[model samples]
Target: MNHLISRAGLGILVAVAVVAGAWARSGSGSVTAQAVLTGLLLGGVYALVAMGLTLIFGVLDIVNFAHGAFMTLGMYATALLATGAGLNPYLSLLVSVPLLFGLGYAVQRHLVSRTMGGSLAAQLLLTLGIAMLLENALLLAFSGDTRTVAVSFDTPLRVLGAVADLSRVLAFAGAMGLAGAVWLLLTRTRLGTAIRAVAANPEGASLVGLDVRRLHALTFAAGTACAGAAGTLVTPLVTVEPTAGELFNIIGFVVVVLGGLGSVPGAVAGGLIVGLTEQLGGIYLPGQSPLLAVFAVFVLVLLWRPQGLFGRPA
Candidate 1:
């Protein structure tokens, strides 16, 4: 079995356990366990969010500020289809993934491409506009009502006396599988080589007559598709409201920045770090809960390894 934590990762895990053991000694063992599990699983969700954001920033040299908007689009679409059209929750991936990929591709080709090589201010402003448009569009279509996607309205699963919704388990599994696949693609394929080439040296790739523009479109589309898939997975657990992507957007960017700009593994590890920080910190500290720990870790990470845990030095 793959180890749950790495040696370096284990050190932090141990520190968390020590503090949580204090809580458990006070009759909070079960709560601590639940928090650990929650952190591990929520890490998977954050992994999904960061996978794409890092990819775009890594490959295209564009910070996609609107990634969360595409994520919101996925969540809303899944909610609409699973609840309104009566589609099976799992099967909705058949539609949501492709539909959003196409949208991402078109947006990149027309809007993002136009702003390529421009000032960072221009790119940020444009994507921010797109994010605003998507959120408002969702508000208009759904009337700001909360919606959700789930298999059965009231069936929660019991595992070893811990109660969790089945959909959440499925979401965690789906996110892991997807992240593994993306890691493989980046490490094991020719297209992956081309992507790394561009990320490493865009001008050199252009000298070889590579279709840099097309690759950018593909990379952006793929990143947004990752976000869409994550949304489809998590819509079941969270409320699918217009602003659903807000928190996720903030954290996802933090993860990418923490993980390093272009390193896939950094993104994944950074996500797990965020997940554990939120859960363990919430339990031990209780008052400030997730944020105090999350930002603390973020700053520590940047201070210790400014290039990110796995990101290459720029």
Candidate 2:
């Protein structure tokens, strides 16, 4: 009951912040409505990114610093396919997801698995090295140039008297759909049960005949595939650059911590909270970076509820 109330309270606070920020921005009812709607839509994408990060951490107990680099790879892959093969950006997901999945599985099986029982520093350094390598490879291939997927659905849609880009709405819808699918997989499927069992106790799972290493690899691959899907979804909305993944990496980490280190649902809630903070901060702080506001909220959340809004007390 307390957890439910806390969640509800957090939601209310975000709602109030959105309303107050919009009202203060221009005192225009339409503008305020637009900001709120835009914030919510963008929040969905953030949730998708954070969900990938949280899943890996929850299951594997490893901080995947290269997660965003994988996302960059996906962005490039989608861009190349969409532009070179004349495929629709969304259609390219068929290639991007599997490609990233294979890459992730190979990396975990060959590199990360070697450091499983070693010091945390080894794992961190290894993942960090992988991130650097992927980013630089992208730089060499794409030359730091910003690219975007050209899509025909660039028109704006009106909702509650507020205008929203159709692409963003579609991204939001896709993110939500994917999140739902993941939740169902985790809760309803046998594979998901094995993954969760491995997460809970690798030794126990191994004793029970589950291949712990395989599960770990599979979980990591699934997480990376989510990043791939996110890359494809955002290709039309943002400029795709090699370094674009860095910002997402930072945001994903923040969401993971803010949501609770290993809580999937908490990650979703944290993403929405961060989205609201960014939009509201943009309005209230006018000239400052919106991330400053996000960091501020992050600090307060850490101080007040270190386990996160939905996390149980340790």
- lDDT (10s digit) by residue, model 2, range 1-314: 88698879878986887687679676778767776788788888888888888889888888889988998888889889888888888888899889999999999999999989788888889999999999999899879889878787579899999998888999889888988888888889999999999888999999999999999999999898888888888888889998888888888888888999778888888887788778777777889998998888888888998888777788
lDDT of 1 by residue, 216-264 (tens): 9988998999989888888887889988987888889779878888778
What lDDT does each candidate get?
0.83, 0.86
Model 2: how far residue 257 lies from native, Å: 1.3
- Model 2, backbone clash pairs (residues 3+ apart or across chains), number: 0
Clashes of each: 0, 0
Q: Which is the leading candidate under TM-score?
A: 2
In model 1, where do residues sit more than 4 Å from their true spots? 1-27, 153-161
Model 2 has an lDDT value of 0.86
Candidate 2 has its poorest 10 consecutive residues by lDDT at: 17-26
